[model samples]
Target: MLVLSLAIWAVKAQGGTFNYTQPDIDSGKALQDLSRIAKENALKRLSSSSSGCTADNVYFLLFHRVYIWIFEEKLRTTSMGGNGEKVNGSQGMLPGGTGGGCIKEGPFSNYTVNLGPLTARDPLAHNPRCLKRNLNTEICRASASLKNTTEVMLESPNIELFQANLQGDFRYPESRKWGFSVHGGGHFIIAGDPGSDFYFSDVAGTLTMMNRPPSRNGTLDDVLDLEPLGEAYTLGEMLDTVGGSPFCFVYE
Candidate 1:
C-alpha cells in the first residue's frame, strides 16, 4: 500500500496525471465586487472634481484596467489554454512565459483577443531574451525602430478618465467591446502614421473626430493637427513642420 501511494505521487509530480479540482467560485465573486467598488469610487471622484481634467484622467485609467480584466475573464471561460486549463491557472501560460492581452482583433476581421509575441520596442529593449535571431527581419526591424518612431506617456493611477455609467451601449469602431472612457489618462504619445486612413506620415497621434472627407483621403492635409503639450511632454520633441498652425491643435 505504501509503494502504490508513493508511485501515484511520483507520477502526479511528473505531470502524468491532472489534479482534477474545481476553482474557488467565491474568489471570482469577490473580484467582481471589488471592481464594483472601484467603479463607484471613480464616479464619485470624477463628479466632484473642480477641474474636469483630473476627473476625466482618473476615469479612463480605472476603466482601462477594469475592462481589460473583464475581457480576460470572459476569454478564460470561452476559450481554451487559460491560466490553469491543463493544471489550473496554467492555461494563461504562453510559450515565453508571457501572459495574454484581453483586447485583440479576431481572425475573421472581427476583433478577438489573442496571445502572441511582443511586437513593441519598450518590451524588446527591456528584455532581449524574448527576441529570437531567426525571427522575421521585418518584425525585428519594426521592434528595434519603435522607440525612434513611437512616444509613450504613462498616466497616473489616481485619475479616472471614464466612469462606469459611460459604458452603456457604446462600441469602439471594429472593436470587441464598449468604448473606453476618459479619467485615468491615456499613455499620450506621438506615433508615426504608418499608412493609416487617419493622416499624413508626419502627423503624430491625430484621431478622426467624425466622418472622413473623401477628398482629403491619402493626403498630408487630411490628418487632424497634433499640438504640443506645454507640460508633461512625453513623446519626442514636437517637430516644427508637423506643428502646422496653432489652430490645428485640439484641447480635450
Candidate 2:
C-alpha cells in the first residue's frame, strides 16, 4: 500500500498526465496508446490538462520513463555480464525481434519499458534495424570514419513509415545487429528549427548522427540539406542519400 502511494506521488510529481488503462497489457496496441499520450504532453509538464501527446511522441516519453528506472539493470546486462560486449541473449535493453521496436521487458518481465528516444546510446546496439554503419554497401561512407558529412531532417509520416516497416524482423541480413553500439545512433529533439516551424517534436534515426551526437551541434541549417523523398527506401538507401537514416516526430 505504501509503495502504491509512493508510486502515485511520483507520477503526480512527474506531471501526472499518463493514464494507465490496463496494468496487464498483453498486446502492443495498449502500449502504443500509452506511448501516444506521453508524446503529446511534455514529460516535464505531463500533468497539464490537455491531449498534448500524439502517436508520434508518446513512445519517447515511455522510453525515458522505463529506461531511467532500469538504468542499473541495463548497465549490468551490457557491461558486467559475460558476453556483454557482444550482442547476445536478452541482455541488451531491447533485444530486436518480431514487432520489437522500442518497448522491452527490461530485467524482469513485469517491468515493461517503452524505451524513449534517448536510449539510442545503449552500448549493445540492440536496435540495428534503423541504424546505419559505414559497412553498408548502399549507404557506407567513403571515408573510413563513421562520422557523417551532411545533416538531414525527416517528417512524422516518414518516421511512421520507417517504424511500420521495422515493426517485424529486419529485412536485411547485414542490418541484423550492431557491432559497436547497442542502441541505434540517433537523437530526438523538441523542434530545434525555426524556419521549419516544427517545434517540440520527437525525432530519431541515423541522419541525426551525421554531426556525431545530434544534440551537441545540430541546428535548423541541418534540416535544409535534407529533402523529403515521397517514395519509401531501405534503411541502407535512406542512409546513402542523406549520409544517415532519419526519422522525425511531428504533429499530425
Candidate 3:
C-alpha cells in the first residue's frame, strides 16, 4: 500500500505533506480527505498566526498513488505497445525503460499523436504516430521523491526561485543547488518519445526572462495577451483570482 509514514513525518517537520496510499485511492477516500483537510487547515489558519493552506496541506499523495495505480496496478504493463499499422521507423526505447514502442491496447490504444517529436524540422507540421508511454518507477524514485518536491515547494520564497527550483534552471545546474524539479518528474512519469517534448518547455521561457533587458520584471501593468482564447487584460486585473476583472474563482 506504500503508506510512506516516514515521508509524512518528514513533511510534517517541514510544514505540510502528502501521505499517499493505495487503499486511500481504491476506497476513494483521497478526494474526501482533501476536502476535509483543506477545510480544517483553513479554519486552523483563520484562528491562528500560521500561513494559509498550500498544495501540500490540501492534497498530498493524490498524484503519486493515483498516477502509479493507473499504470502499475490496473493497466499492468510498463509499456503501452503499438498496433501493427505500417510505419516509417521505430518509436524506440524511452529513457528509463526496457524496449518499448507504440501502444497496442487500452482505450487510448488507437489514439495517435499528430505532430513532431519536435526535435525535428517543421516541428509543428502534422505527422501522425501511435501513442507511446515508457512508465518507469525508477525514474520517479530518482527524480520525484517526496523530499525533492517538498523542498522545491517549501524552501523557495519567490515565484522566480520557486519556478527555477521546481523547473531545474540551467543557470544553476548543480545537484547540490537543487533537486530535479517535480515538473520534470511528473512529465517523465508519462515519459516517452514525444512525452519528453510534450508542451513547450517552461525552462526556456525562464531562461529568456533571465537574459532579457532591464524592466522585464513583471508588474500589474503588464499585459496578458490571451488572443484567440480571450481578450487581453492587465496583469493587475487578473491577479485576484476571486474578484479580479475577467476572472472569478477561488482556489481550494
Q: Which candidate is the best by TM-score?
A: 3
List, in order, the clash count of every candidate structure. 46, 18, 5
The candidate maximizing lDDT is 3
Give the per-residue lDDT of model 3 (tens digit) for 50-130. Answer: 322222221112222323334453445445443332334443453445324666675667777765554667554567887
Q: Model 1 Cα displacement at 93 (Å)?
A: 12
lDDT of candidate 1 over 1-252, digit per residue (tens): 222222333343344543322352334543333333433443454454332322113222222333444445557665522221111134222222122222122321222212122344332122322211111223223222333122211221221212221221244232212222221011111111112211221121111112111122222222221122112211122212236322123322
Which runs in model 3 stand beyond 4 Å of their true positions? 1-100, 103-128, 135-147, 158-160, 170-177, 195-215, 225-233, 245-252
**Using TM-score as the measure, what is the rank order of every candidate, best first?**
3, 2, 1
TM-scores for all candidates: the values are 0.19, 0.22, 0.41
TM-score of 1: 0.19
True lDDT of residue 16, candidate 3? 68
What C-alpha lDDT values do all the predictions have? 0.26, 0.28, 0.49
The Cα RMSD in angstroms, rounded to one decimal, for candidate 2 relative to the true structure is 17.7
